[model samples]
Target: MEAPSFLDFIIHVTGLPGYLVFSWFMILVIISLALIVRSSLKLMPEGIQNVAESVVYGIYSFVEDILGKEETPKHFPLLATLAIVIFFYNIVELIPGFIPPTSNLNTTLSMALIVFLYYQFLGFKRHGIKYIKHFMGPVWWLVPLILPIEIIGHFARIVSLSVRLFGNIFGDDLLLAVVFFLAPWLVPLPVMALVLLAASIQAFIFFLLSTLYIADAINEAH
Candidate 1:
């Protein structure tokens, strides 16, 4: 059997699921870091503050490029928050003795549902009742066929987002566990490097898909 992570050991002692506990721990850590970075911000922007600013600006630029300046300001918060949270959740698995929250289907699904629902809400908000036309086909006669297909396709986004994140993270974690068990030394180093790359890519892909979904929702064109 694979060894229990540090949080898993805590589960044995505390009788709570380690993933749930560690998720809360990670949330607190992210919040604390945000506060510290905010408090230490300077006119010149050095150290952690500078790094944070760079990340935020990079995301902002990406969002603006896709969403345009007017829409970017309105949706940037949700997009930025999703990117940061997902990235942190993904990379947490790289730390020994901790299970990444993203590795859990529950966590990924919850985030996926959030993105799905939020964009749906934005669609209705932006276009009101006319948003139903998005589901309907280009021609009035095709409503029955197109509506179902569009609805199913929209729902599938939730599955796509959640499964992709969970599968990648969980698979990477399992691979690392097996590698460490067999070699327990230098052999795992390269695997760790690959995992790190996968983690970053998965996070960015999630963010990109989310932006596309939101764009589709608010799009004026049918």
Candidate 2:
């Protein structure tokens, strides 16, 4: 097991779960960062504003490529928010005396469930009752067989999204703990760097999969 975070003291005092407390901390951190960035924004985009704009524009371009210009505006907020929040949650493990909330299954599963339900809602909104045709397969005769399979597959996305993120982050934290135990000094530096890269990749992957799910939901081709 990993060493207790500084938040553990607060957790004990408040009788709150560590993940719950840290998750709220993470949200506060993100909100504070957003406020700071907003206050620093300039018309010409210099300093922190430039970096923030670059990050937002890069994310917007990515969404545009996947979702097209028209749909990108509608979906970019959720995609960008997910990517940024998940990235922060993943990378927080690098901070001393902090535990990443993403390392917990509950946090990951909750986010996955939100994505799953949101896309389903979008599908129903876009196509109404006709959205049921998505489960009926390409042929009308396959409804009975395909419906259950399709339902299972759709539900499986929640498991896939949640488990994949939770497993990776939890494994990363475990590895870090073991490494720190074995070598508490310079040896962990390289590992920390790799963890940072992995965190970024995982965040992007979640974003990409979410975009694809939303695209599938809104596409009339379904």
Q: Which candidate leads the pack in TM-score? A: 2
The TM-score of candidate 1 is 0.93
List model 2 lDDT by residue over 69-109, tens digit each: 99999989988999999999999988766788999999999
- What is the per-residue lDDT of model 1 for residues 141-182, given as tens digits with 9 covering 90 to 100? 999899999999999999999999999999998987788778
Q: Estimate each model's TM-score.
A: 0.93, 0.94
Model 1: ten consecutive residues of lowest lDDT: 1-10
What lDDT would candidate 1 get against the real structure?
0.89
* Residue pairs with backbone atoms closer than 3 Å in model 1 (clashes): none
Q: Give lDDT per model, in order.
A: 0.89, 0.89
- Per-candidate Cα RMSD to the true structure, in Å, reads 2.0, 1.8
Looking at candidate 2, the ten consecutive residues that score lowest on lDDT are: 1-10
